[model samples]
Target: MELLELPLDEHLEAVEKAIGEWTEQQKRRCKSAQRTSSVEVAKSEEELRELQKQKLELLEAIKQAEVAREQQKRRIAANENETRDLQAEIMKAEPIITSLKSRENLHQGNLGNLNQESNKSAQAHAQVVDELMKGISLYQKLGLLIDKKRENNLAFIFTQLDPNNPNREFSFSLRIEDNPDVFLVENCVPEVSDVNELLDQLNKTGNISTFVRAMRLRFKNLV
Candidate 1:
């Protein structure tokens, strides 16, 4: 309320204090800006280093690619030589293949001929065996029929009868009972009186034995 005048020195001193305070404030703002600039510079340096590393890697990869290309070219050259050698071998084998084919054809023809001959021989042999067995069987029946004739053939058949028989000590035979080649034999003992009668019955049943045996003996003598 009293308009009392202040001293000029005091007023000047207050102005100087205000100026110092403003200067301090500006210094703080400058320090903050400087810190922000330093951070930006560090980030830029890190980015540049990363880019340089990437560039070196790219250079190394390019060098490896060139080396791989050279290796591929060498492999191709070697394969070309191998292909040439294989082609030559194929050409040389042409004559051998032709000769082998001819030999195979000859072998096939020989095998076919051999198979035909073998089949014919086998059929002939089988026919001969059947005929021989049939002839032998017919003779056997005729001879047995003569047993009742008191012939020596009856004695021979008796001797040939099973010597190892366990259930029977004797065997009986009736020849020419039905067919000329058929004989009916049983395990039995015969009466000596029945022998002559049995031979008579055989002669009547198989009337062909005497003539057949005579002819067989004659034929065998000629052979």
Candidate 2:
């Protein structure tokens, strides 16, 4: 009976040793799996943080874009307002601009007319000067002295009447008041007998120089 008990005790000790080794192996495996799970969880947390950072950056970009769009819309609206104002101003000033253009054209026309009238006046003045020069030359050549007392009155003196009477002068005055074709003679130096007949011839011929020459000849005959 002692020998059978000793063998049974040794078998029981062996069985207990086997069970403890298996439990130790299971504990080591569980610890390794927990370490791996912890590593995976850390990696997942880092990826989540990266995704959140990216989302924040995207949101900021969208916000900036929205602000830029708002600013652009405001600028566009302001430009439209300015354009409308400019159009209104142009509409208001259209009539004034047209009136100014018309006035400028009228002023140019008036200047043109004034230039033409000045040219005509210069031409008439030149003609009158030429006629006056001709009359002065004719009087000088005929040895006649004419003095204008008024617009229609004149005094005439014949200087070269007779060679013997060198100092003798035949003077007369002619006046025209009412009639342009008729002349009144007065202030005769020599009392001519055919003075009325000479005046009739002068009225018929309308030649004052011929009448003066005839009077001079008549005075020479008397001398």
Compared to the true structure, candidate 1 yields what TM-score? 0.51
lDDT string, candidate 2, 109-173, tens digits: 99999888767755654554345445555755556777776655677777766677665787778
Q: Which sections of candidate 2 miss by over 4 Å?
A: 1-14, 107-223
Residue 101 in candidate 1 has what lDDT?
A: 99
What is the number of backbone collisions in each predicted candidate, taken in the order shown?
Answer: 2, 0
Q: Model 1, range 39-104, lDDT digits (tens) per residue?
A: 999999999999999999999999999999999999999899989999999999999999999999
- Taking all chains together, each candidate's TM-score versus the true structure is 0.51, 0.44
- For candidate 2, the 10 contiguous residues with the lowest summed lDDT are 124-133
Best by TM-score: 1
Q: Which ten residues in a row have the lowest lDDT in candidate 1?
A: 151-160
Error of 2 at 69 (Å): 3.0
**In candidate 2, how many clashes are counted?**
0
